[model samples]
Target: MICFNIIQLFVILKLCSGMRYIDLKSNFISDGVEVQHGYFMTSGKYKMFHARDPALEVIQFGETRVFPDVDYTPGTHSLFVEQFKVGDEEALSIYVFRMSVTSNSVVYKVYFHMSEFGYKLIDCAKFTELIKGKIHVSLDLSKSKSHPFFNIHTKEEHGQSTTLIEIRKSIAGFRLRNVEAKRYEFGRIMDSSFPIYMGYSKLNMFLTKATSIFIHKEDNRKYIVLRHWTKNIRFDLMTVNGILAWNAITDPEPSLLEDMHQKVFRLRDRIDGYRALNPLSTLDLAENISPELLGIEKVTGRHGGSTYALYHLEIGKEAYNKIKFVVNSEMLDMLIAKIDDRTLYAKVEVITNSQRTFLIITCLMKIDLVYETVINYYDKPNMENTSYYHVPEPYQTKIVSDMYKKYPVLINMDIDNPPSIVDHGELQYDSYILKYFRIKQEDGRGSVLSGKYAFGDIWQKDLHEIGNIPYEGNKRRLKVIAHSVNSSRIIVKPKNMEYPLLPEELQDYVIIDG
Candidate 1:
């Protein structure tokens, strides 16, 4: 009995390692990890100090200020620790630490806040006096609907503020892939390697580590969004021994996955007035429609010249025409730039005001690649089918019968052997891609596996306009990002000299570090 208890404790300790500090950061939402902003730096707790361990002269501060250091340690793990010990008397430290990172470039946006007792201070006033108000400041700003900054805090920035972001070549980060107060407020995506390499063998290897596995179905393609709660999934790790014992504890087949996947994506409660848009009248809510941009032409009227964007949406044997009015040629240039080779399309809303009826580009429904690291993915299934659980897809739209095949459909296209974006447009670019990857050293560079595509080292980040004002394109939240930040400070840092098949249509992974 004694030996058994000791063994159990040992097992628990081993499992408890590698836990995350999830409670540190608030909701840092980014259209489902589609885009990432500049580095989030917090100097102080910015909250009510619950505990003050007198043993430590000062509290912890970093990306997650006052958050508990990982490993049950006391100090936060910033990318770099800045300090100045005046003399033999004592040490005064000022630091900026990044969130926890494993063996990969992706850093988890998580931190914990436990009482600090790591290092006791000899002179408390000296340390506290220099950095009291520096860490904590009153955020006078209101959480107004009109305010742009997601992080509403009032911590005063120090002189060395830019040193943290600028000193480093680049940094890759992820907030919780979540939605709050909106239609869906799920947890953060701990990892997207499952969706990144689902059909491949990657999902089988890393499924057990996922605390909650969700199947996100947009159109025909279903994406696996894996969420692992920090410290919660301790005992449920997928070690080598765990994998060996998987057969005894889990299902023997992929039936659960198949069943869950086959289940169609259903709509929950309608958030906006979209459902009540009166389908019988001039405006019909486009439930499940993919309209391709036919053409854009500039028309000169008696007053001035106006550009118009034409779209052809096929809805069950009938073609719904949509003409979008543009303000100027610059708008047309931006639209054409995004829709260069690939068919640029949007899900639109038709509106009429008794005089003229037109289409308001509602959204560009797009699924972009989010790069993540995975130990491996295999064919093992846990006992519970996670799909059957969670928020149910509430409302179901009536059948449109495949839009009665308006556009040409290539039925026999091979999804298994999808096109490889080695280089740009033509076949000659293959050599260029080969040259580029060889120079980058395919396996050595720590890029994501090339199973999905030839060179898979890319991520999709939503790049909105810099300030509070959102990206007001022809289509709202346009599915596009400039290669560089381009008059903005929100570019993703170097990705293992990273690569991401971005701008979905082009499959162009811009060169930053390499």
Candidate 2:
């Protein structure tokens, strides 16, 4: 009986596993004509073509309209037709064409032609190919009004020839061969209103639908506008929404000015903090100081024209601080040519102290003269000078260290391995305790110690074989010392190139030697 019960349990488990892997398909059909299996109607002036599916109830052909004939090739004439209901009644229809099937999926070429003008079915395959990949169509029905219309335009490359039309209407149901089908209900409405239809094909898998609303209000007037789009649809929805809401409020006075003032204050505070940290970094010097010295100057020429020169300078820390505080203040409004060289110049800014700003301005002044100590000789000479000033670094390092201390190091255990040394400190170590016998001490007193004290062979093998342990206790501790170190190891001693043994394979693996 026990054996039989076990067999029954095994069978039940197998069935459950099989059930989890099952794929079910639901079929839906609407009151429309299918266009896959060929069908024809002879009761009208134009024969209606449709598919053999029972879900598609009626098929009617729309009259073809063409523009004025022009002198063109015989086969180049654009020809297209729409299919609709016989009595001009509101009805939905889907046009499906079997192409090819592969693997477990069937491919069909679909086009959704609506009765509304300017509505044309977007070819899924062609659209996917244009996008360079397949994407599923996301359908959004929340903002749909009466039926959604998709406008599509197709044109051949390098040519002006094209065809445009409005086809199929009142698409209440649709289905793919050997796949699932969906049905939509369109309740009683005017002859102009019909159910919404969505076209899908194997090639176009990714699609999205979105909706938007716009509102405008002024004085006592209010306007609400709703807009929606699917991967197959397009239209602009709104310019603004809060405009109407603000107008509706009792107090409509603009408060944006006050908000702007508050934002400015906050921005100023942030800038002040940044400037405090980077005291020597200056934008004013880059804009005003350098440009003034490097401005164009006129030399000897038939036409007096300006010539500009580029100059650059790098200064040491001591000179950087002095220039920062003195040059800007003493020569704020001074002309470049009078102070130093006026031809070309540059300044190098560096951070020295949080409280002190620094700058090193170098200038190249040029003078153009046509003359000579001897007759029939001309010479032009240019002069350059470099200078800088800034606060000392002993003060800067102190402030930087204080700022670093403000943000303490936080150890993250979620990482595969913890940092070896956090904030310039080593992690605590635990000794491994062993349960075996112990050796006698020099003073003739013996105590419990690791098994390695007497059984070296067994202890060594156990240390290599045992996996990582949480902690070492007095009783079950191994004689070996296993340290829980962080991943980033800065080895200061024995730097000659020695690889440290990793803790264990299961715990962590080292990707780099550190």
How well does candidate 2 score on lDDT at residue 382? Answer: 24
- Give the per-residue lDDT digits (tens) of candidate 2, residues 233-264: 22111112111111111111232123323333
Top candidate by TM-score: 1
Give the whole-model CA lDDT for all candidates, comma-separated. 0.23, 0.23
Please count the clashing residue pairs in each candidate, in the order shown: 24, 40
Candidate 1 residue-wise lDDT, 154-256, digit = tens: 2224321111000111224332221210111111122322111121011212222222333333333323333333321111222221111111122213322
Off by over 4 Å in 2: 1-397, 403-514
